[model samples]
Target: MNVVEMLQEEKVVAVLRRLPSETFLDVVRALAEGGVRAIEVTMDAPDGAELIRRTREVLGDRVLLGAGTVFTREQMQAAKEAGATFFVSPHLDSDLMHAAREWGVPMVPGVLTPTEVAAALRLGAEAVKIFPGSLVGPGYLRDLRGPFKDLKAMVTGGVNEDNARAFLDAGAVAVGVGSSLFPRTDLEARDFASITKRAERLVRAVRG
Candidate 1:
């Protein structure tokens, strides 16, 4: 399937941000074990490119790997070289959009206002991401759909198992879940089982 189709099918993208490198793979494995097929490792993580490369090598085709929080051409290029099939950024940028096109990688750039959404589409973003999804809630997506019915939007930030399905029902193609999926205390305690259970719960909530 195409990137967008795969994302819609997965219904969830487990986003890992600045996680402890030592347990990175463990966390990924746990998520995948819980049936999450799409995963994103944010660029802010230490040695992010290498981590992407390693995850691709280790996970093979079992998971769809993506690079998140991308804002520059350099970051996009590095992520592409490191085997990221898709790129996601918190904001729209022309340079990064063009790079993703040239490299033949799908990019999902964040957009808030209707004007920003139009700009992102014109810039060739494969999909638009609504960051700080908490600010507007699922109702906002429903409102956007009234005008941009064909728009593929991924909701991120402040997402949790409780509201994941609501976002999808409101027109979100998928949701990017971060800290809610990997609680800090659980990570510190190496409670991978808990992470797995959370992942499973989210998958059920969104995909049901």
Candidate 2:
């Protein structure tokens, strides 16, 4: 399936930021073990391009690999070249979105307002990520859906097991979880088991 179809099927996107280059594969394995079928490797991570290439090689088709925190057309191209099937940005950038579309890669551009969402759709974005989702809460998502019922939105930031389902119920097509699902302290301590457990909990929350 294509990137957007894969994301819709998975219903959850596990976002990794600043993962240790050495342990990136191990982390991917742990997340996969916990039933996370999609992963986003943020550009901020060390050697992100090489990491994405390696991740694509290692994971193969078992997971849908995506690049996140993309802010420029160059970054988007790098990600696409590195074998990322999808591109996710923290904001709506016309250049970035258009590049992804032209390359036939799914793009999820971040937006905080109706105007931005409309602009992203107009630019041919596959989906729009509602960033810093914690600040606006599910109530904001519900309100947005009222007017843009066909809009595909993925809630990101400050999302945890407790609120994951709420966002989906609030009309989010999927949820992007970061530190809450992959805590830095836990990862630094090499607590893969804890991360696995947290991911399982989130899976249950979203599935329910």
Model 2 scores worst on lDDT over the 10 consecutive residues at: 1-10
RMSD values, in order shown: 0.8, 1.3
TM-scores of the models, in the order given = 0.98, 0.95
The TM-score that candidate 2 achieves is: 0.95
Where in model 1 is the C-alpha error above 4 Å?
none
lDDT of each: 0.91, 0.86
The positional error of residue 182 in candidate 1, measured at the CA in angstroms, is 1.0
Model 2 ranges off by over 4 Å:
none
Error of 2 at 84 (Å): 0.2
Best prediction by lDDT: 1
In candidate 1, what are the lDDT values of residues 38-133, reduced to their tens digit?
999899865889889989998988998999998778887888899899999999888888888888899899999999999998897768999889
Deviation in Å, model 1, residue 177 alpha carbon: 0.1
